[model samples]
Each structure stands twice: as structure tokens, then as C-alpha cells.
Target: MQEAKTILTKFNSPTRFEYIVRQASLESAEAILNLNLGGVYVDYEPRRFHVAGKQLARGVLGGVTVDNLGSSGLELQYEQELKGVVGIQRVELSADGSTIPTEAETIRKAVHGSDLILTIDRALQSQVELELSKTIQEAQAKGGIVIIQKPSTGEILAMASMVTTETGEIVSTSHNRAVTFSYEPASVLKAMTFASVINEGLGVGTSKRDIPDTVILEWENNEGNTETEIWRDEYEYETQEMSIEGILTHSSNTGTIVWAQELGQQKLYDYLRKFGFGQASGLEFPYESQGILHDLNKWDPSNLNTIALGHGISVTPIQLVSAYSAIANDGIFVAPRLVSHIVDPSGNMERLASTPSREVIAASTAHQVADLLTSVVENGTGEKASVNGYKIAAKTGTSWKYFAPEDSYEMPNGQRDPYLDINGQRHYTSTVTGFFPAQKPELSMVVIIDDPAPIEEQFYASHVAAPLFGEIAAWSLRHYQISPFKEVQLSDNNQQAFNGQTIQEGGE
Candidate 1:
């Protein structure tokens, strides 16, 4: 038998090298080269790293892979750890430009990258993604984002986003919209606003005050321009006399604004900062948005009232979820985290330290806020989000989608929400966020449904996002096998205890 080989083409470039070698009469030309038959051998180059879990959380687990060339999501945050240092070598060649028959001196050995153990629960993420896609489809919505986190540690278990494109195709966007997409977060923000008031000792949970449905506000700006605007609730009604709990329970816009003013702008701004708004999420995920936070100096006359109703400001889903997580964690704000551990090439595992955390409010204050949120779910707008046997503490937000030019969420006029066109038809972003079990919470979540088809009186988050939150929360409870009938006593410990239950404490 005769065998022949030919170099059909040779190519080289700064980024790569290629040789089109053709081999005839061989079962495996590449294998033969690798076999090093006779005195010949093939010098192969090191391989580039590839990513895993592409089928699930592809956008979140993005890294250097044949599938994704650029750094994104978790890959972007842990690039250096995932991609080891390149190796270097020193070798001598003969006069003929061939390597001498001697071992090459290694100038620098390659260091393998650490393997990342993420906080994501594969099964839960899969389920959340499916449900989010289904919810968007059923609502005839533009897109949606859902996130599940361990409130105590701020570990994200599942984060998913899906969009139905203009062409009517369901697709996961190139970016992790959960961390990247920012919008007016509407009524869910009411909880945070009220939280500020309660934490500052300006008002207690049971404090009562009259809240109006509409208010004409006027103020001067840093630009020395006097602005006059009218801020109103989604519905028309007379002034409401209620306590802080009743206000949040009914999702009263005026109620929140009234208290915010009582807390004062500086304190409101300071508390919002403590809640993780307008700041990096610390995950350092690629292209994470800090959302739109206007400086206190930039506040117009109506900025407070408008923002209280979830306009004139924007927030990423991540920032919003982390804020809720703080309340769930007994007022401790734990920075959200993705990677949980790193394993070296030698198989030695090193657990990463927990993310940065600080107490943003007193435990009693957090308890009061959680109780109020629990009431929202039990008797108010978030009633639809209630799951059987679970005391879910959550709030629903329904806000119009600000239709404007690129990077233009600012409502300078602050007189009218630009979310509606000339015809009075509107686009909406609906959201529901909070934690489960109310006390001794285990999980926190935020679900946002973007631009759902506005049906009269049905565009509210109570009708859109809350139901979805309930569905997923139910499934998550079953997945984790969290006993619905758990009983733990408060330290006060007596015949009458926390939740009126007396049981032995349990630990994981």
C-alpha cells in the first residue's frame, strides 16, 4: 500500500495558526501524528478553556468557551480565577532551526484556574426559567425576570430572564437582564420607602395619619427652576386615614410620600443607600446596572412624591431583590453573591468568605416591616401571592413603562408619567418581591413582568406578577422540603411565644 500526505494550505496570523494537512490511506491521520511513529512527533498546543452548564443558566455562567467568547455574568466576575495564567518556556534550537534533543527549560509554569462552585441550584433554576417564560407568554408580555436568593447569606439560587421578541419568538437575551435591566420598580418600592420611615423612628408600624389620593406639589430645583407638579394615585379617592401598616397594606401612594417627607430627604436618601439602591451589587457581574439614582441636589419639587409612587427613578432587579433580602435577613444587608467556592487544579477546595453584610435596621424594625408585608400578602394587593400554609411577606408593584429616548428615564416635567402614549393606552412593568415563612425566613425573591398587555383594571401587579410569585414560591418550598408547620419560640419563651408556638429549635 502506498500512503501520501500533502499540505493543501498553510496559514498563520497574530491570533492563530492553521495548516490544512491532507493525509491519504490512513484510518486516523491525527492519531498517527499523535502516535509519534518512527522519529516524528506532533507538538500540540495547549487548549483554551471551555464553559459548562450552557443548557442551563448560559447567560449567567458565561465565560471563555467555544460557545461564548466574551466575558459575561459569572464568568466576567471570576475571569481571572477561571482562566489560569499562560505558561512560558525557554528552549534552544539547532542551527537548522529544529529543537535540540533536550528538555525545554520552563521559564514559568502554567497555573490552572480554580473551578467555581456557584450558589445556583440547577433544578430550581430550571424550574424558575420555565415558569418565567410561561408567565410572560400567558400574559402576552414583552419579557420577564425572576430571581431566588437565600436571604440569610445573599446567595442567589436561581436567576432567570426571558423575552418575547418583536418577531414573536421567546429567547433569553444575550445579557443577564436580571442584573442589567433597570426600570421603574413601582409599588414594590413602597415597602422600602415605608421601611425607611419605620427604621428612622419617625413612625411606628401602627402609627396613624391621613393619606390623600392626590396632591399638587411644587419645589425649586438645583437649576433654580421652579417646578410644579401633581402626584396622584392610580385610582381617585378621598384622603385615607390609616396607620403605616394600613398604608402599605393598601399600597397607598400618598401614604408613603407623606411619611417620606416626615423622614426628610436626607434620611430617605441615606436609608435608600443602606438598602443597596444606586450602588454596585458587589457581584461585579459584567455590565451590572446600578440603576438611576438622582442626587439629592438634583431633586425637583415633585421628585419625592413621584418617586414614592415608583416613577422618576429606576432599579435593576438585582438591586431590588437584595433590598428585599435585607428585610428578610432581619435587616442585615448581605451583598449578593454567585460563586460559593473555588477549587484549584490540584483538587483542593477553598470556600470563599461570605459576602459583605451589615445591619441596616434594627431586628425589631425588620420584624415590624416583615409583619406589615405579611399583612399585604394576607389582606391587601398582594393577597393573590399567598401560598397555603406559608406566611409570605411580599408586595406587588405595577408601574407604567417609561417610553423615552435611550438612557432617558428622567421625568423632568414630573407632572405626568411618560408611560402612556397620547391615546391613554399604557405599558406597564409589574413586580412582586419579598420572602417566605415571614419569620425566620429562608428565601427571598423578586419577579418582574415587563410590559404586559394592559387590560382595563387588570394591568396591576396583583393580577400579573403576584400570582406568578405564588406559583414559584410554592414549588420552591416543595423542592426544598421546608416544613410549612415549623414552630420556633422567640427568646422571650413563655406560654405565649413567637407565633404562639413552643417547639425545639432545629439546625441545618
Candidate 2:
């Protein structure tokens, strides 16, 4: 290629350069336009389109056919400083080009349009980001997300995401995992379960309150073994008898499933849909998963049983938080929000409001759920998640991962799908999502750790996920300028004991 000439120009002056828009060669220009170079004026001196001697004519310039794609920041939005001078220097084009100091400086300044204001507290975001980074790295987690939302108003205080860094490079393993990843929320859905069941009049009972150890269903398999599954209310500790409250407190999958079935599939589905289960949160992020909930018309015999207990359906973190907000806001569904307001260039404020959903449960039902959830933390599986001065309610879920062949096991008696938990042996998604100041809630959060390393006999949510919630919640409460309810410090022994309790209770 012949050496190109340099040409000095100004922004939006319609500098003379021509290329057919439909030409495939011009497609590269599209990419350049999309590439955000800090939205600054760049010095353009062509290396390929230059002509001989005193530079080609301006009308039919002999320089690179550069096009001013557009400007960003205040320049484009508020229509400020639409035009700027460009510096041109004749130089040989290398395989790769770099930004000139003056051009780079201009772009950098342009990127910040009169200091963009954010609803999120910078201090909180920074602290949460730092803590999340450490957790993601240390745990070798697949990915993790931390979100703090004001339960009263549905405002997101902070949102941070981090994943494992492979090859020692900080690679964003995935996009925003919170609102995007829609996996089985596991037992975290139990809070909804409890609310719906109680709304239907099933009073809270103990986990070991003599429900039915082994319900022998008529559905049998080839092995001739009766379709009987064992109902063991054992975590890592001694198999303890728990009431309906105890069952949720302990996150007994068996008990939860039983109650879910009693509440009826249709009722459960209605409550779930009301909670925005099979829908979107209406956020601005792209590719937000809507979550899966098989239509009720196609319900199977085990559908209600499984779903009642938080299986067979899927949800995103934002969806979960928004649903939980119903309880926090006294049964009224306040849509979760990120952007507080969008301002025009002329200082005009346009509020970006979150769409509100109708109240799903009665305000009384919401208070009941909040109270029960508080018990889950005060006297249940979520005990590890407690903050001394503040009242918090939460639940832990450990899901079993089902793959191909092993997913279906046919026995003469019953069909069994054996999976494990965070402990490498076998299990499903283990997670914990909850809110704090239970009586009068303020912040709501969810923590999902795909497969945590097993701490003791069981891979429990309280053992792994709850502490993470506690840490994040405490940090967030302080960061948001919310007065600390009280100081909470877990002794090494007490924390270990709580972890051990969770492990022992993992089998309910």
C-alpha cells in the first residue's frame, strides 16, 4: 500500500471522505463506531489513503477514509462541544496503532460527562466488590453475585459480581450471574412455600412432628421393589424431631415437599406466579432469563410435591428478591430497581420507576411469613446467619445435581435419583437467600454457591452460604449508612458449632 497523508480536521465539519455504505469493506467502520474510545476526539492521519507531496485535496482527501462515527457523553446527550480540532501527524502506519497523548486526554475527559451521578453508594459498592472478589478467589467458586436491596422501597443499594479467575487472569467468567442465571433456587423457595401453606391454613409444625416417615406411593418400577422412599430427618447431628416451624427452620426437603403437596399444586403455582416466578423483573440488563416453571395444566402427580418444596422450578436472584419484597413490604410487590433516575442533558430529571405487582399474599400473611422466617434465623437452620443486634430471617437449600444415566435409577421398590451436595460426594445447588430486621425489614439478599466444598458430614447451606450472607449483609448495612442494630461477633467455636448443626441437619 502507498504511504498515506495526514489531514487535520474538526468534529462534525463533514470532512470529505467517501465509501459506499453497503460495501463489505466498509463493515469494519461499523465495528469502529461501536468501539467506545472514551468518546474523545482522535487525531487522524491516514497511513493507507495518502497521496504524493503536499497532501491530497480536502474534497477528495488522500488520507485514510476515516469517518466520524459519533460522539458520546455530554457532547452527544446535552449537545455540548459538538466540534473539536483534530491533530494530524504524518507517520508510517504500523501493524498496530496507538492513541496520541492529546487525543487520548480529550477522550478520557469526554467519557465523564460532568461527573455521572450514581444511586449506589460508591463506598458500599467498593467494599462489596472487594469482599466479593476475595470470596470468589478463595472459594474457587464457579461464580458469585452479591446484591443489597432496600426491602422497603425495592432500591438496589449495591450489586457486585465475580467469578473464578482461570490462568491467573481476572476474566469475568460470566455475565451478571444474579439476574441472569436461572437455576433451581432449591429450598430458598421454601419461604414462599411456608407463606402459601399457612395462607391455606396449615399451621407451622415441627420437622419431626410425626408427618409420615415413608410415604409409599403406588408408583413402582422394574426391580419389583416397592416405590418406597425413606424419609430421614437427619442432618449431621442426631436425627431430631422438628415441628412445621422446625421443618422450615431445619429446611427439611421431605417435610417441605409434604406440606407443598398438601397446599395443592394449583394453589402453589398461583402463589409462585404471583411472585413473578415464570416472568421477568423488567430490568435494563440484556438477556435476563425469565426462569422456568412448567405450566400447571401439565402437572404430574409429583409436581406439587416437588415444587411445593422448591424443586422442579427455576428463578433468578432479582426475581427472588422482588418476590421476597412482597413480604417485606407487607404483601405488596414493589418491583426491584437499579437505576434511580435518568437525567437529560439539560438537567431535566426523568425517574426510572420499577413496575409494581399486585399483592400476592394478605398483609397478615406477609407478617406471618416474616415472623416465621425470623424464627428460622432465631431458632432454625438460618441461625448461623443471625446478626446479634438485628433480627434477620433466612432459609438454606441444598439441591441434588442430576446428570444423565444416574438421573434415573429404577429399583424394584422405588425409583431413586441420588445426587450429592457441596461435599464432593454428590448433590445439587445449595443456596441461602433472606432479609434482615425481620420485624421491620430493611435489606434483602440471596447467596447461591453452586457446589461448596463440604465442611463436615453434610454440604449444608447455613454452613456455607449463610455466613457469606451475614458478612455481606453486615458490610452492606454499615455501608448504606443504616445504623447498626447491634454488634455481632461469632466466636470461632460458636461459628463452628453452627456449621456443624447445619451439616447434621442437612438430610431432613
Candidate 3:
């Protein structure tokens, strides 16, 4: 009825929609064949949803596309573009169910699925996956994710994830964590506040303030009761006057909150949403998370000062990267994309529309914030993330993993992890995100390490995520041949790239 059928063609549907159940359970099949009840035999249908066999990328590839051909989902990413119109056929069949080609004539030809030209670099994706897996093993942590993007074009070159399954297996996750997973982003979000403050002309990167050891956050709760929360630095510190750059470089929780209070609630919240928090990143991936952003009226004390310190708010890795990408792209927030374009059957390629982009901050403000972040890598908490000659603009974040359920974090298998913070919960997400060669940004990357070991030390973003960021960024710089700036200061631990080889000057 829909046409496009080949009348005499002896072929199956070319949609690639329903792949065969290649990895069926051998046990079930054997049982079915050997079934015997004395002189009588009976057979039963196997379980509807059980796949058994080795999968090359059981998790990684499982999350790809829609249906049995590769994955399982009704709404696959760009399914319409991928699933070409099916060609129809009308052919006579004998009693044996064989097609009678002699009695049939061609009606229409089936159109094969379109080829998706993705921005993801296969080699880079593999490298990222390897590094993420290695990091998970080395840290002895639960799992992690890494993403690499081009600032100017919003093209995602690579994204990889490994997660702890319900069965406690550390394997590549079936879902793209970059777009789906949301968590408190800690200090990596400080850039947003800084960008806003600078955009509002309230402060500059070098603007100095007398920071205190602690600040009391008092605000009305959802119940209309006045609530008070104390905001303290991760480490003990006396009252000190520090520059805005210093506050971010050191990632001072109290210092950030104190300044964020200046912007007021409405302004701060506005900027947060504008930066793409509490909203889906425009990447438009299937099942993309918008992250948790309460309405302005629904905000509590935590949403204010606490959020300024990168707490209380939830954000996806894609959102965080896109926000930073705006700064790297001269204040333009270009939504990330996986597929570059699509190619039709006739080899005619249909270029996709431009990625959603908007100017989040002025170019000058973004530059100022970028410079501040550069200081972070050069002489702040993100030192481990620095490349010797490349000025890096980045931030380190380590926040207590917020488990909504009291004293329990839910597992994938519908089980709750029965552990509290005091019981070696080790619930912490460490993250680092930045763009390199700060003067002229090229690449933006985000590294997230979930629950690194030794809570007292390795759980810190600097120790876990920063080093990984440096490793991957260093490799990318060399691979992409990105030139470095003048030799002003050389890194100590970061003096080398892949192996013991000294990292030469980028200009070299």
C-alpha cells in the first residue's frame, strides 16, 4: 500500500530494524530440543527478554540507536534519517513458501537506511574509552565518564563511560552518561557564577574581596520557614582578602557563596538557567537529561549560596561542557552534536542544520573568566590539570554525592545500597572541565570520576579527574598539533606527556 516494494526481489526487509536473536541462551535451546515426557514430548517458548552470549560491547553498543538491529528503543536518535523508506515487493509463493520469481515482476526498490556522518572520531572515542577504563581500574573507583568537544563548532569528538552495574560489575555503560547522568557539579560550575558576575559588570577576574572562613546562608524554605545553613570551605581557612581569580583558583566554597550573595537570588538563578542548568542541553540526544533545576520560586537556601559553590544543583556532563564551551567559543553557547550530517542512498549528503547556539555572555566577560580559569591551572587547585606550555582554563570539582533516598543510593537492579556517609560510603563525584591554549581556545574537555578511593585524598577532583584530564588533553594537543604559548613556567609532574618523554614546547 505504501509502495517502494520490489515485486520479484528475493530479499528480506532492508530496514535493519529487527536483527536476529544471535546470542540466544544455549541452555534454553538445548532444553527445548531434548524435552521428553516418557513417550510424549512438549516444547515451551523461551523467556521473552533474555539474551545470553558474549557481546563485543554489551553496554556501549547496546545504547546505540533503536531496535533489535543494534539496540532496543522505540525512539532512536535520528531514526527517521537512519531508517530509509522500505521498498515493497509482490511475488508469488509456492506451497513450500518459496518465492515464485518467474511469476513476479519488480514493483519498487527498498531504500536502505541513510548513513549518519557523526562528529565522533572512532580513534578518539576508542582512546577515551581506554583511558576511562584505565582510570576506573587504577582508582579502584565505581565508574567514570570522559567527553571531548570542539568549542567553535559544538562537535562532540568523543564520549566514553564506564559504570558500576547493579551486580557490581564495572563495564562500559549502556547509556551515554554525558547526556543522561546528572549530578552536583561542585566547583566546575563556579565558572558560571564568575561569567555572570563579569557580565553584569559586578566584578572582574582580578577583583579582590575579603573572604571569610565561613558564611551563614539563611533563606526561606519551601515550607515558608527560615532555614539556616553554614557554608564552609573544604579546608579550614581564616578570614582573608582574595581576588575573584583566587577564589575560583582555590575553589573556596565560602568565598564563592559570599560573592554570589551579591548577585541576589533572582539574578543568580537567571544566570544559572541561562547557562543551561536545570535544562536539557540542546544536544537533543535520546533520553537526554535536562538536569535538576528548581523553579526560581521553588529555590531554597541551598539553591542560592550553596549552588554558587557548585552544590545543591544537578547538571549533566553535557550541560557543564556546553556552558564552558560558550566561554571557549567567545561567549557563544553552541549546543553539542554527534552526527555531522546524513548521507542518502544516492550518495547525496544532507548537511544537518546549525547546532543551537546563543550568546550567553559578552566576549569580554567570557575572556575575563577564561583568564581566571587559566590562573587556576597555572597556580591553583587545578595544577595537576595543567600542561607545561599550554595555558589551560579549567576548574576542579568534588562534591558529596547526593543520594535522595535517606542513607541509601539506589542501584540499577532495583536495590538500594545500604550505606551512609559515615559508613565508608565514599560517595563523591570528582570532575574537571576546561579548554586549552587559553588565548585561542580549540578544544573543550570534561572528565568525571565517580567515587574515587581513599576519601581523604583521591576523592578530590585534583587527584582523580584532573590528572586524567591532563593526560588526555596532553595527548590531544600532540595529536591535533596544537601549538603552545611561550615558555613562562614549566610543570613539575606535568612536564611529561604519554610516557617519560618530556613534553616539548607546543611551538616546538
Off by over 4 Å in 2: 1-118, 168-174, 204-209, 219-232, 235-242, 402-428, 455-459, 481-508
Tens-digit per-residue lDDT, 279-330, candidate 3: 8787767677888878888776567787787877889998888889999999
RMSD of 3: 10.2
Error of 1 at 402 (Å): 2.0
Query: What are the Cα lDDT values of the candidates?
Result: 0.81, 0.62, 0.76
User: Per TM-score, what order, best first?
Assistant: 1, 3, 2
Better by lDDT, candidate 2 or 1: 1
- lDDT per residue (tens digit) for residues 318-393 in model 2: 8888788788888878777655665554566666555565888888888888877878888877877887667787
lDDT of 1 at 154: 88
Quote the lDDT for 278 in model 3.
87
Per-model TM-score on C-alpha atoms = 0.82, 0.67, 0.80
Residue 87's lDDT in candidate 3:
55
